[model samples]
Target: MDVTQVLRMKGGDGDYSYFNNSLLPRKVISMTKPIIEDALTNLYCDMNFPKTLIMADLGCSSGPNTLFVASELVKSIDKIRLELGNYDEPPEIQMYLNDLPNNDFNTIFHLVPNFQEKLKKQTTPNSSSPRCYISGVPGSFYSRLFLRKSIHFVYSSYSLMWLSQVPEMISTNKGNIYMSRTSPPSVIKAYQEQFQRDFTTFLKCRADEIVRGGRMVLTILGRQSDDPCSKECCYVWDLLATSLNDMVVEGLIEEEKVDSFNIPQYTPSPKEVSTEVEKEGSFMIDCVEVSKVNWDASTDHNVILFEEEVQGYNMGKCMRAVAEPLVLSHFGESVIEEVFERYTNNIKISMSKEKTELVNVTVSMTRNR
Candidate 1:
């Protein structure tokens, strides 16, 4: 499948839209705020606080999370200026929101006016907020999206795990949609090699665009273990594969279709990420952190439910918002609701036995001269 043509979150603010179901990503943004602030502060100081700042938020899906980074950066810079006694001369910002061509850019554009007004309200009477110029750039981040040496900083969250395309030789990865304990050795090797190639290309492209000493911060779903079949990385897909297999048995879908489909995502280990960065040789890794978030993280943690049904339903909706387009394109609209319904039941049963969590990795880097 041509992933660029199909990979996108469910659009709009409807019941199943990404905008309503993106609490997990929003939580991630909050969790990494310190790292993002540090990177921006260092970039601003190192660049001597340029009068104009240019930056991009890669894979900025249509949601409030799209502008969360921009807001944070502005607040950080404003605080820095206040401390340095330069609040009177606020910098101008050129912000780019980037994603695949199919993303819901209209929803994001509609929010811009309110975003600007919020910024205005935050400024003190004695000082003015920076004038932020926001524009949408539709494309894949695996390729160049900015002029050479033009960007001052870059940020992406929960995006890089998606390979540009599925591995060419994974046809033998039957019965599974991602790396699994039952998958053949060749399937695992194909995935690892694919990630190395795509990640290297990503660094090379960004190196050409970001100026020397520019900062970049990325967060992705990742595994702590070097083993590709580790539960942290592959278990969720396993559950999804199980859901499809159940449908196949009930004659709801063809086994052949299930055998041919594979998700175009890979959760690399921290070591894997460092290896690619070092091998690519364009950026230096400044910080790497690994954290665990419950699959039902968006729900209130203080409320302990005796029943797992609510948690399962929450997770099911979240995954559907992100994966529905891909599934819909492959299996047709008929199977979308049934497949997710089965997936939710599977999650409920599994959680009844034991809770599951996702492993997230955050990396901070700087463009080298």
Candidate 2:
């Protein structure tokens, strides 16, 4: 199956939608706020505070989080302008929100009026605010999405770990939907090579579009261990595979169906990311930092645990929001609820024994002259 054609977060603001379950991503954005603000400040000062600033949020999936990012950008720049006493002439801002065509752009568009009104209220009475123009650009970021040297800054969060497609050799990966401890050496090698190729293509495309000295900040799902199958990186998928296997044992789904499924996602190490950036040679790495967030970080810790079920259920809902579309496309709709049900139970058992965390890698870079 072509991943680009089918891959997208579950849309709309419904209970199971990514729009509602994206607290984890919102946490990621908050964790990286200092990095983002630093990058924007450097760009503003380095460009001598240009009267017009052009930026884009790549893979900006729909919801409040979508405009939440835009709002952050506007506020950061406004703070810089306020510090510099440039209230009389705030720069005009052109912000592009890009995602796959399958993403719910309509939901985002409907929220723009409210976003603008909030910005208006936030502006001080006598101070001028940046006149911001927001537009949606629907397409894959792996390909060229902007004019040459036209963009000033770029940001993406909780995206980029997804490959353009599953590796051609991945069909040999049986009994697993992602890299796991049991995956053969060949399967692991194929995933690594695919990420190298895809990440390089991404850098080359962006190098051509971002002007010299323009900056990009990316927060990707990543692992700290050099071992690709480390528990922190692959345990979630292992639990998911076990869930499918249980259904297979019950004859609810064919064994071959589970054998054929694999996610088009890879979590690279910091070394892997820096290696690609150095090889691509278009951008200077300002910094690469790793952070760990608990699977239940968004949930209330005050909740009394009835045998630790809440954390598992919350994680199950979060994973479902992110993975349901891909799973639905592959297995059809009938098994969605049952599979996640089993998956949630497996998580409850595992979380009882140990805490599970997601490792995120945040990279800040600037285009070389």
Top-lDDT candidate index: 2
What would the per-residue lDDT of candidate 2 be over residues 200-225, giving only the tens digit for each residue? 99999999999999999999999999
Worst 10 residues of 2 by lDDT: 298-307
Q: How accurate is candidate 1 locally (lDDT)?
A: 0.88
lDDT of each: 0.88, 0.89
lDDT of 1 by residue, 1-369 (tens): 899999999999987888878877888888888998888888888988789999899999998888777788788878876776765589999999999999999999999999999999999679998889999999999999999999989999999999999887735788888888988898888888999999999999999999999999999999999888999888888989999998999999999998888899999989989989999999999999998888777554465473477777777788889889999999999899899998878877777788698898999999997
Instruction: Give all TM-scores, in the order shown.
Output: 0.96, 0.96
TM-score between candidate 1 and the true structure: 0.96
In terms of TM-score, how similar is model 2 to the real structure? 0.96
**Candidate 2 overall lDDT versus native:** 0.89
